[model samples]
Target: MISSYSEYKSYLEQDRIALGVRNDHFSSKIKDFLFPNYIWRFEQTLRKLEYYYNCKNSFWSKPTYYYLKYKFRKISIKLGFSIPINVFGPGLAIVHYGTIVVNTNARIGKNCRIHACTNIGASGGTSHAPQIGDNVYIAPGAKIYGKINVANNCAIGANAVVNKSFEETGILIAGNPAKKIKEIDIKKIIKHI
Candidate 1:
């Protein structure tokens, strides 16, 4: 949980590092911070920051909390990412901004890169959401639903609807109710990313 200002700063730095912006000099960092695709991630971080600020019992908390919530809501509408503050891990990358959504109960791991039009959400009578793993890549229009567990280093191809668990790591899953397409070596590919 992002319960402090230090935690918020760390998450921002983690996002920058995941995006390969290690240096983060003033101009470059600010440019990339507001870059269209990347802005959703920053907004998500802001939501978490707002959550922490609201937890404090100070006189200043009200104004700050409301301001951050207003900003978060405004940006969320613009970006179309309906995800909550708690679900994503530190190094999330929203590669594109169009129509992406995640259930608040969903838990995504670190360094996951999700593209446009993806949905990580609930399904059927189940009250739970998908649990995605570290360094996973979700392509455009992919849908991961229910209490499914997607293991680390896996990739969900475009338009795949994942409904069940794939506990085995390092494979490609794609289909209507997604199945393992083939074994994949994400470590080699992630080096370039």
Candidate 2:
């Protein structure tokens, strides 16, 4: 959620750093554009549209926001991501571009490194989605749903189905009903966060 220009810039910078983009300049940007890390492009458009929609009410903002929203939808469809705006905080790292579906109601905190085939959604089409904390690592093929609250610095392993909440932080949760496997140093896993 970008409410101001400075906040938008800061969030963009944090997102770049989270994605391991070291430099920001004309040349580097041109290179990235040419090579096209689609995820970066998606995030850039997402931030821009969010900023325009949230902060501005001028005439130009409306058309620009709609156009960017169209572009954002195209990119997301191409990347197989269904993440909605304002759902994720700053420093979100999507590790791959495949089958990452998040509910519109889910609220994930900053510094979340989520892998492909992960679904953070509500159950039975209800609005009871998960509220995940900061610096969490959601591994590939994980399915976390319902009205659960995952603590900060938590790691959800691959293919784990988490339906319940885990209040303890700095723990690794795995297995089909997802339990605390062990306590881990989250920094070791989410290095960018």
Candidate 3:
């Protein structure tokens, strides 16, 4: 929860700097207090949109879909920009925004970076959800399902489907059914960062 528009403005500035983007267009102080609420509403609208597009029809009904669709459409008209729902634990980061779904039951650890078009959800209609460890990097279009445990310091490659538990550290997993490809140098990643 961002407390105020000023704080959100500052955060946006910081994010732009972190992303190496020029921040000449934004203001440090927000004159309008309603701006934060508008942004939050926009994010919720985009979340509902992403949920509608990605979720299975069996997972949600027609009435619910139409209701959410109408709600989001209203919010979109009000906010004037589409925002994405961004869930994060302590020290977690999402690089790109849009088409990211994380189950409510899923437990994500600290220092994790997730890209766009990723889905983390439960499998087999079970209550149990994924427990992702620290320092994990989940790439774009990846899906992690079931009550699987992804180990620390691991990288899940683009479009990989992870259905089983992984305990290895500093390894890259890729494929339809994900498997370890090779040992990676975590230090190199830090250097680039």
Candidate 4:
């Protein structure tokens, strides 16, 4: 979990930079921050607010935390994202935000991109959840469960059900019970973005 304001700010910048937005034109940035396809601005704000709430200190006002928390709850209900407080890592990119549920135990890494209708949780009454690595892209309708360790630079294709672990990086996992389709150069794909 993020403990400092600087770290949270860094995550906000990373999330924006991932979407091709630069630190220019304050008006446009504000507009984008207010409205986007995935409402990343709202999600990041909620995450940061929760971080501040957990590590309460003099830096942030109590009233501010309360207000943000209230708004966060409303957004969660409206967006159908039942993400628990402080579970997600920084730079989490929500490609679309509807019917997305991530267990509080799940630990996702930096620059992780998530799509709509995705579920990342546990199964068989096991409390342990998935630990996804950096720069991983989860397509729409993907269901990832169990104590899986998804590697960095990987892609979980649409509607793929990831039941096991895949530590190997830069591979595309697809199908119902997900399997390695092929090794992809995600770095190259990211560059063209």
The candidate maximizing lDDT is: 2
Score residue 148 of candidate 3 by CA lDDT: 94
TM-score of every candidate relative to the true structure: 0.84, 0.95, 0.58, 0.87
What C-alpha lDDT does candidate 4 achieve relative to the native structure?
0.80
Clashing residue pairs found in predicted model 1: none
Per-model lDDT: 0.77, 0.92, 0.63, 0.80
The positional error of residue 2 in candidate 1, measured at the CA in angstroms, is 2.0
* Candidate 2, residue 59: how far the Cα is off, in Å: 3.4
Give the winner by lDDT: 2 or 4: 2
lDDT assessment of candidate 3: 0.63
Which parts of model 2 have CA positions greater than 4 angstroms off? 24-27
Number of the candidate with higher TM-score, 3 or 4: 4
Weakest lDDT window of 10 consecutive positions for candidate 3: 81-90
Give the backbone clash total of model 4.
Answer: 0
Q: Candidates ranked by lDDT, best first?
A: 2, 4, 1, 3
lDDT of 1 by residue, 122-152 (tens): 9986789988888888889998899889999
lDDT of 2 by residue, 1-193 (tens): 7899999999999898899975657988788767888998898998888888788889967888889989999999999998888888999888888999999899999999999999999998789999999999999999999999999999999999999999999999999989999999999998985
Q: Write the per-residue lDDT of candidate 3 for residues 1-193, one digit (tens) a residue.
A: 2334454444454333333333254552253332444434444444444455445265546677677778876764553323223333333445654666777678766456677788888888897878888667889899999989988778899999999999988889999899999988654542223
The superposed Cα distance between candidate 3 and the true structure at residue 137, in angstroms, equals 0.3
Error of 2 at 110 (Å): 0.6
Winner by TM-score? 2
